[model samples]
Structure formats: structure tokens, C-alpha cells
Target: MPHGDPPVLGLVAGQGQFPALVAAGAKAQGWGVAAVGFAENTTSGLAAETDWFQWLKLGQLGKLVAFFRTHGVRQVVFAGAINKPRALDIRPDFRAARLLWNLRSKSDNTLLTAVAGELRREGMEVVSALRFVPELQTPAGQLTKRGLSRREQQDLEYGWPIAKAIGRMDIGQCVVVREQMVVAVEGLEGTNAMLKRAGDLGGRGGMAIKIFKPGQEEAIDQPSVGLSTVETMLEAGLTSLVVEAHTSLFFDRDASVALANRHGLCLYGRSDGQDGGD
Candidate 1:
């Protein structure tokens, strides 16, 4: 209620570095971050990083709304992902249940978009979490000393649209292909699980292709990868990764690249139909 107070932005944080990245970016830009973290789904250390922090269960829509209203937050950004397997256990309150009742689809895009709409109705604008952290966007070109080989390039190009199409259907964000045959598709279990299956089905030297879905909620929910992705790919015996550049998130890039290099794997950033890597 005081004049000269910095604008407070509400952060609906989920898991991983996404929330922290947004919080740091917000503070760096001179904005106050009032964050709510999901129990067991968020890092407890995030409490120390926020101006105001609350731990809430996944379906506490009423509490979430009241908290932001109490803090006079007019803008909100959703970052990170709810552990979908764990999300099966959420007990939606009456408010969140009411919102969930009318949904025809419970896909990630559908649910998040609906939640954003609810926030908008409550006078809180849900903006892209990357608004302040534009640098988190993936870089273009070969990210490791090992660039794409001819076969790897074939797989990347072959799988890009398949991955994007899966995303477009709001199914998931990853597809595994080798020698132009799709071996795995990401489903409810998520990427790492899918990679494990690809290893069995595609054998060694497959490529994993990930991309931002066409018509996805831009910069809100995105395709992303990091060191864990490379580690999973290594475990899966996949030799190359091609993720959409400047559109998707690439967390822990240096660590991922170093790991990929150690294994002589290719880490290529791409945009659909736009090949900028060697």
C-alpha cells in the first residue's frame, strides 16, 4: 500500500531450476518475487531465494489466489513442472476441483492454460516465466566438439517433425528415432522413462529429438533438457540430441556439453526445418 514499492510478481513454482531461474531473473530486474512452491515437488532452498515464499499442495487454488491477492501481485508466471506421477495424488480443493470439472482434456497445455485463465480472471496476468530470463533459451549450432555426423543429421531431421507433432497433439515433447524409424514416444512417464524404453527398442546409436510444440503456450510450458538429459541419453546409448534452439530451455548447458563431449556424442540445437549446425 506504500508508494515507491517495487512491483511484486507472483511465481507459481513447480520443480527443478526453472523456478530459481525465474526468481533470480526477477530480482535482477528489480522486481519482487512472491513465490509458492509445491511440497515435495519444489526445492526447499527456494524458500531462501524468494521475497515471500509459501509451500502449497498442487491443488490449492483458493490458497494460491488468496496469497497473491494478499501480496497485491498483479502479474504471475508459472515455472517448472509438476511431477506428473506425484500429481495423481493431488487433492484438489473445491475451487480447483470446480475448474477441473469442465475440462475435456487434462493434457499439460490444456491444464496450464486453464489455470492461467483462472489467474487472469482474478486480475493476475500469467506471463511467460522466461520474461526476465531470456538467456535460458537454447543456443544455436553445435554445442560440443562433436558435431552431427551424417547419420545423426538424418535422424535429427527425420525426428524433428515427429517430436513437434507429438507436442502439437499435446501428448509430450520427445521422440526417439534411429535410421528414420521412431523407437519411442514420450508419454505420461516423461522423457527419462521414454529414453529407457528407446534403449531397448532402438539399440545403440539412436538420436533423441525434442522440440517445442507448434501452437504451444510460448515460453510458458516448453521443451527443455540439461545434464540429466545427456546422462539419460548416455545410459540409453543415444549418440545425438537435437533440441529446438532459441525456443526451448537448455538448463546446465556447460555441464551437458562437457558430458556429451566426454562420450563423443553430438549436442545439436536446431529449429524446425532450419539447420544451423555443422
Candidate 2:
């Protein structure tokens, strides 16, 4: 539908700023993006960022497929986090119902994998959000003005393995630690909520570690953080955040760094495998 010459991108949007970031990035690359928004989740402002936009129910598999096909979309990327509880209201079409019934496991991995396979079958390649947003990749070293103190580094060293172990169990990719003790383990609540919970439990500030799953599927789900994460940490009185360098995505890095520095938060990006273990 776009007049100019541009590669078509299908954006499966969810909640928060993640979808908007991805749309903006793709559009910046001269891609005509068709963003599909959820009813109560995605911000309608995302429409202006994309070449085409439509709101579809979570279970509208047929509509999603049709939107991509009509828009000549060859590349698809899912962005943002969907509130799983709200998805309970989904009225899956026959296609989605069949796919759901066929899958024995219903984790995010399984669901996304099935959807990816279906898209691939339709000649649409489901790509990672990192494809165009290269700057989002977490860089190694101290990102904020305040570098990780020896004590916090010790806690990060201890928490990395624990966080990865939890990720391996398909639980979550984040854990908050203080003095080598886990103050919180992220579950269904997500990173921001987990950070607040950790701050409440730990009192004052603590270190937050986010890591990728041991054998995570590259194209589907890669762990990511952005400015909002730093904001959450500040709200929770957290002074340190550790992310798996290279493996995780850190969007809006400059703004995140500026915010972190303003709040005295130490943001460390390190390699999980290289962090010498206990």
C-alpha cells in the first residue's frame, strides 16, 4: 500500500514502548511497516510510525496472516510484552485453535515457534527485532557513570548463574541480588515489577541481573532492556543493573545511561560465560 520503494515489514505488536521502538527503527531504514496492535495494549500512536496499521484481537490468526499477505510483507518481527492474563480472553480461530491443540507445551517459546513456522510456511520470514536495531545490543563495560563496585560485582558474579539457571528452567531471565543473596526472582510479573519487588524486599538499592536462556532460539526471543528499565530501577531505589553483554539487547542506551547516571545506578554489561563462577 505504500507508494515508495520500500521493503514491507509486518510488526506483531504487544504492550509498552517496545513495539513503537521497533516500528520507528524499521521505518528509519525505509521499510514500509504494517503494525498490528492489540486492543487494550499497544499505543495507537504507533499507527503514525508505520506505513499501515490495524488492531486485531489476540486470537485473530486469520486476520494477522491476511494483513501480512495484503501488505506484501516479507519480514515479520514481534515486539513488546503481551499481558498473558488478558490473552485468556482470546477467541482463537480454527487455525490458531488447531495449532494450539497440536502443541503439547504452551510456553512462550512453543507458541512463538509455532507462529513462526506458520509465517514461514506463508513465505514470511520472522526475524528478530535486533535485525535493524543494532544499537540495542548490550555493550560490554560500565554503561553508566557509576561503575559496578567490587561488592556489586561479586553479587553479579553470583547472580548471573542463578539467573541463567532460572532462564534454563523457562522461569524468567532476571534476578535481583544484594550481598550475593537473591532478593527477587522474576517470574510472570516481568522485569519492572520484579525490580520493584526486589527493592521492597531488599530495602534501598540492589543489583538486577538479566540473562538469555542457555539455549534460547535466536530469532524468536532475545532478552532486552531499555530506558523504561532504568526508570523502574530508579523508582525501586535500585543502584545497579547487570545484563548479559552481547547476548542481551539494551535499547536507547544513551538515554538509559544518562538516566542511570542521574540516579547513581551502576549499569554493567558483562558476558555471562566469562564471569568467573563460584
**TM-score of every candidate:** 0.95, 0.91
lDDT of 2 by residue, 1-278 (tens): 46667889999988777788888889898888998999888888888888899998887888899989998999999887777668767789988999899998777777778988999999999998888777778988777777877788788778888998898877888999998898999877888899989878998768888988887777767788889899999888888888888868887889998988887888888886775321
Task: Kindly report which residue stretches of model 2 are placed more than 4 angstroms away from their true locations once superposed.
Answer: 1-5, 276-278
Reference-based lDDT, residue 55, model 1: 89
Candidate 1 residue lDDT tens string, 192-268: 88998999988999988888888877746878899899999999999998888888888888889998999999988
lDDT of each: 0.87, 0.84
Model 2 residue 148 CA deviation in Å: 1.9
Any runs in candidate 1 off by more than 4 Å, and if so which?
Answer: 276-278
The alpha-carbon deviation from the true structure for residue 177 of candidate 1, after best TM-score superposition, in angstroms, is 0.5
